[model samples]
Target chain A: MHNPSQSGASLEISDLSKAYGSFKALDAVSLTARQGEFLSLLGPSGSGKTTTLNMIAGFTSPTSGEIRVDGREISTLPPYRRDIGIVFQHYALFPHLTAAQNIAFPLQRRGMPRRDVAVRVAEALEMVKLDGYGDRYPRQLSGGQQQRVAFARAVVFKPKLLLMDEPLGALDKKLREDLQGEIRRIHRSLGITFVFVTHDQEEALALSDRIAVFNHGRIEQIGTSRELYETPATEFVARFIGEANIFSGTLVRGDAGLALDTPVGLLPVETRLPAGRQASLVVRPERLEIGKAPHAGSDPHVPATVRDVVYLGSNRRIEIVFDDGRTGIIRGSGRGTDVGAGERIDIRWSIADGYVVPFSSSQTGDGHGS
Target chain B: MLNDTRLRWLILFVPVAVLGVFFWYGVADSLWKSFASPEIGLQNYAAFLQSPAEMAVLRRTFLVSIGVTAVCLAFGYPYAYLMTVTTARLRTLLMVVVLIPFWTSMMVRTYAWVALLQNNGPLDRVFKSLGIGGLALIGTPGAIMIGITQILMPFMIMSLYANMVRIDRRLLDAADSLGASPAVAFVKVFVPMTVPGVVAGCTLVFVLSLGFYLAPVLLGSPQHAMLSQLIVQQVSQLLDFGRAGAMAGVLLALALSVVALGAVLARPAIERGYGENT
Candidate 1:
């Protein structure tokens, strides 16, 4: 019988904040996720992603704020009463119990019939593709096997929300990728709300429906992977998410709308910012095009000399020094041109290809804001 | 490789020589004294084993040791668990309480139990005030159990605490997050992980209790005489070296057998218990 309450509860976290004396681990953070959506909290260490997950799992109390599941507030409830499942970084499986017994724990605790518990445990083992590993203790199993057991144990009780905190951190690169696929498959089949936390950008980009980028105890931006990559809200998000070359200059009104006046000459921008204020040009490396002569169009063409070329498998990163003595990098397929060091080149990028971030020029003479 | 082997053998040779001199050498001399003196050929061994009176005392010794073990486990397990869960200051306080008993002399501890359990003593006075003096427990089997448990309780708690500290607390957290209430998680996850400690503590207390002399003398009457009392009497008052040597040999064999049997039973648990095992 399907539970009337099993409606795939949507999660709403509001104004969640945590402080350890003077150091604020988490600021007023709020987010919402539709039921059955896989959302990832992506950030560097000490950026409060784990703290937010901890608060949602009821492991730690928020200094102030509330968490709601389908309009039900569960801020003060104990962990066991909150009906949440959590997978830790270390597997944390019961060392004395076999894989089957470990999965059977929560079901048995809920007073489910003994026969039903056994049936569900076997079902869960099958779900993780560990059907025959029921009798091995944690020490006897491989790291990947233990990881699957931990995942199986968390979901066997049919929790409507699963929070995983860097669950693949301890495994090698190959196994991490392997278990990530398993986790994505399980999330699809379970149809429950999934909130994952990780610092790896590629993992977050590959697995999340929407990624909330965290920085200094705040969520800087939350959106689809392409949105965050193409147009980040701040310089911090641009630098943290992936490789980028940022150019700072004064914003000026131009025929193309707002253009940034830097040492390398005028460059077009797509965003609105106060004229004459110090702003930044956030350009993804792949957006820049290099050739012997710049392509003629509405794009901004600048002159540069190739200083070094690094050969990455599918692409080559052409490190260049502009004529203005400022450095810039252009990533492109190495097949395009046989450009070598000391070659004069021209780089072209359309105004819409990059973003502009304006900061308070009052904060610093150099225009870097806190 | 040859030099390494020679150095390793030299390192092992010291303890082997020490055991040979004090343990095997003493055992061979005692065996000779017991069997050869007062006419050889198993005469004294046969005499001691055939006496029903001495057999009864041996039987009682085992019963008392078992009783003491049970009592220690009942109190020691909770005390050790408390040490694991408490705050730092409270843990220090509990540790002091456990180690204070160990610091006291065994004779003094036995005498303390006697002082409290005797007629119209502090404990009996409380019972008398409650009009239950008819249940006077002094100079009985219960007194010996109480006295021995107090003396041996420290060893049990320390051994248990050592193992409990190594248990990954995150396992309990994982259980709680999986929808187990705190009480259920503790019973199902935490307690099973501490089996090695329980087995080790119980064996230590039981084997050590069999050789107790002071507590049984002070707290128990002659009607409840144990094997240790018989061995002590044979040597101290009767001056029967041959009889005492024979009885000492028997006690040594019993203790060794208990340890050997325990090792055989506990091997699997030691190899595959709570933490990483290879």
Candidate 2:
């Protein structure tokens, strides 16, 4: 049973920034997590997700920021006084300590009675499904088992907020998937707020109630997994969260409300960006309909040559090269006539299906569409 | 592959041949002389066991070696820990500082200590300036310990540093996140993990201290002669090879037993602490 006082704590981090000389690792980043919220900070490597996690755990002091837990400022506190639990990428389990002893370390430090410590350690072992592994040393365990011990050790104290920095990054895929489900179950049962940092978008999408996408030391966007996938705010979020076919052009008013004029043709666009401004139209592969010729409907269509087709069990991934020499993918259903390489085809999507992002100067020449 | 194996054996045979001729042969010759020289009997051993003065020299040698080992560990543990935690540039500087004594000969360092520890030397003048004059440290066991600890510290540091470099420092951070304060984390987590290093350093310093000769002969008084001094006096002054051989045999046995005991004490800690899989 969880203690009533240890249910969860709301975390509010404001204007957190860390600068080493002129290079800012985290720049004026701000975010919050309500009690019992499962929030994930997702980004590529060196994107400040880990820096934000370390600052919350008090392992690193920010250049300027305030970290508050349940309205109490803990920015100036030492890590031991912060009472936050952190799980590292490599499980930092004490090799000399047995599973039970490692789990009991925090409780003993808190001056719990010895009898109570034993009871709590036993409960923790069972909680991590390591009931009989209390006597074994860390080396005697497999990677998955050692990580389970690390997770048990972190949560055995029942800290209000838990911060994990790529906790599953060291495990194999099957083990990682299993642990992800275990982590979600534990989060729900403990009802504690969790701030997890990871680079894997699928892991973030599978785990978090709200995902914060980080890039270049700033929060690109923060929203639920579905919201991030369906309606990304920027080109970076659109490309980073999932696959997107991007077409860069100037926005122009067409028969449709707004269209992007590109080398191939005018593509339908949907965004708040005014006309005559540069923008990029993002279309998900599944939204684009591929055919030998233009469909009977009024959907905007563009001619493209098929470059390759990879058949999945349920669907096929068809890679197509546009007339402008840019590449795009289409998730063709299993029923389409076998489109081979070098075959010309027409691809179209409805106006509402295209999402437009303001074009910036940074998106050129990276060869991102492949 | 057969030629490679033959070449490996030839390379190994070189050291074994040299040791067999120069080292083990010498040991066997001395053991034989301890029993056979001047007459066939245990006369040299009985003569050694009979003399209270000689027995006192044996006891004092062991005591001084233990004291030197203890002092070396007290100073070297923190210094080696500092080497592991400091930046790479600072660590290289610290390493060079520790090795400066090693660059010079041991005799020269011992003579330097004689100057510092001798009566009214630089150390004495400093004490006098501080108004704590009349402290006679030069001829005492304290002076001998100081000389030997400084000379043998590099051995202790090297042994400790070799083992300490492999320690994963993030365990301390883990301890901190688990609610242990810095001091508690050091004692409960960090210190225990470094047990192998501690054992290695102590064993090296203790064994080296047992065979120490020049430092004690130069810095220590004749009235407080160590076992080496007694063996040398027996051979060079008393002209008794049998008695000297017996004393050398005793020293070798003492060093071997200490090393074997250290291995016994350290095996479990080394196995448990360095599993490293986690």
Worst ten in a row by lDDT for model 1 chain A: A361-370
Runs of candidate 2 with Cα error greater than 4 angstroms are A2-6, A363-370, B35-47, B87-89, B128-134, B273-278
What TM-score quantifies how close candidate 2 is to the native fold?
Answer: 0.94
lDDT of 2: 0.87
Cα error of candidate 2 at position B91, Å = 3.1
For candidate 1, write residues A16-118 as lDDT tens digits.
Answer: 9999999899999999988888999988888899999999998889999889998899988889888888888898899888999989988987889999999
Report the CAPRI category for model 2.
medium
The residue pairs found clashing in candidate 1 are: none
The CAPRI classification for model 1 reads as: medium
State the displacement of the C-alpha of residue B269, model 1, in Å, after optimal TM-score superposition.
3.4
Model 1: per-residue lDDT, tens digit, B87-177?
9999999999988879988888888888899988989999989988665667788898888999999989987898899998888889889
